[model samples]
Target: MAKDDSDIYAALLQAIERGEFQPGSRLIETELAERFKVSRTPVREVLNRMESQGIASRDGKGGLIVAELSQDQLGELYDIREVLEGFAARLAARHAAPAEIELLKEMIASGKLVEGEARELAIANKQFHQQLHNCTHNQYLQQMLSSVQRSLALLSGTTLAEPARVVVSEKEHRMLVEAIENRDEDKAEQVARNHVKNAYKTRLKIELGW
Candidate 1:
């Protein structure tokens, strides 16, 4: 699309990810246009793009609203993530370059420094996973993982926001990276799968207020 349209689309998507426009909240084209200082045409285009990605949908009132995942849907998404990420970790154990491994180590170190900063820690966590996906060196796997990561944005609050969870998560990251470094594909896959499972448990605690 045109540059302006693409910018508007990205901005709108970021807004949704940041929970500015909450789940199931109606999205009026005119309101978005005014808020973004853009015209209705670009706003409409962005909304259409988001809808196609399952990020938003038409509400009962015929207006578009941010998409909300039911409990079952969230569970299914995590199941797929566990499988895909486990595979990625296996591949990374076999394929990652020395530099890539070094980068992963650096990411873990940086994550430790940012443990007290929720937003920074969240961004670091995302970067670490993204780098791990790239280390797999498979374009198709990377694309699927990227899509799953985007869907995760629909969920409000970072799992790392909990201080106790941050400690556990960092330890998991270290374990996964160590497995990759040792070229232990099975261990790497298992660690990655368990990491996702732990994340899901943490998500449940937050979602259910446990």
Candidate 2:
């Protein structure tokens, strides 16, 4: 793909993630083109790419709308994520270098310092998880985790938005990183799974008012 096309695609994805377009909202090519200051051709190309990823789909009126996940679908997604992330943590424990472990610790420390800034903390949290995935040194696992991360963008708002949740999340990150640093694969895997489970619980509370 050309650079412009890639940029437009990334921009559209970010817009969706930020809830600017909203779930199930129609995405008109002309409107998107005007919003992004791009031409219709690039917008069309971006929309096609999004459709292939199941991020957007054709509505009853034959126009594309943001894809919304059902409750069952969201639960399934979290279940898969729990398994994959736990495996990644196990692999990372065995494979991560000393420097990688140190980096993960630093990321957690930085996140703690940004307690009041939900947006910044959310980005930090994402970077920390992505870093852990890379530490696993398995390209296929990394790709799968990346797809799961994209699906999470469909959910509005960040779990880190809650101050209490942020503190608990930071503690979970610390425990997972410590397990990886000690090369305790079992502990790392268990901590990682619990981390994701807690996140799913928080997501349910926020999205479903459960």
Candidate 3:
């Protein structure tokens, strides 16, 4: 990938992740090229790569659109997340450095300051999970978790959007950290799994407009 192409790719990915290019929204190469002030060739390449990564898909009309997950697909995605996150927490309990533990604690503390701010807390939540993935000390696990996180960006809105969910999620994060701090791998894994489960429930409710 040339520098320009890399830049274009990253920008497009960010746009998708930020929900600017919403799921099922068409990605017209010519329009994207004009929007990014680049040639259609690079836009086409970026779209191709995104399609291969499951970030974009064919619309059955010979055009590309942002990937959309059906309800069943969403449930399957969360199932994978539950297992991967639990394993990451278990590994963190076994392998996280003292500094990493302190960093997670600091992150949780900062998260408290954004209690009522759903968007901020949502971003913080992602960072916290990424830290946990880093603490796992397994590159393969981290890579898989990273891919899951990217796929999650296809879902619009955050579970933390509700103030009640935000409060509950904060407590869940604290519990996981405490379990890890105590070096209780089983407890950490269970807590992390529960957290993902709660998130899945909330997401399902949101999807159902409840």
Query: Compared with the true structure, what per-residue lDDT tens digits does model 2 show for residues 1-210?
Result: 234888887877777778898889999989888887878998898889889988888888889999999899899999999999999999999999999999998877764425658767877788899999999999999999989988888888888887778878888888999999999999999999999999899999998875
Q: Pick the candidate with the highest TM-score.
A: 2
Task: Name the lDDT value of residue 8 in candidate 2.
Answer: 83
lDDT (tens digit, per residue) of candidate 3 on 5-94 = 789988888788778999999999888998889889988989898899898999989789999999999999999999999999999999
lDDT of every predicted structure (CA atoms)? 0.88, 0.88, 0.89
For candidate 1, write residues 20-64 as lDDT tens digits. 988899989999888888789988988898888888888988889
TM-score of 3: 0.93
Error of 1 at 149 (Å): 1.3
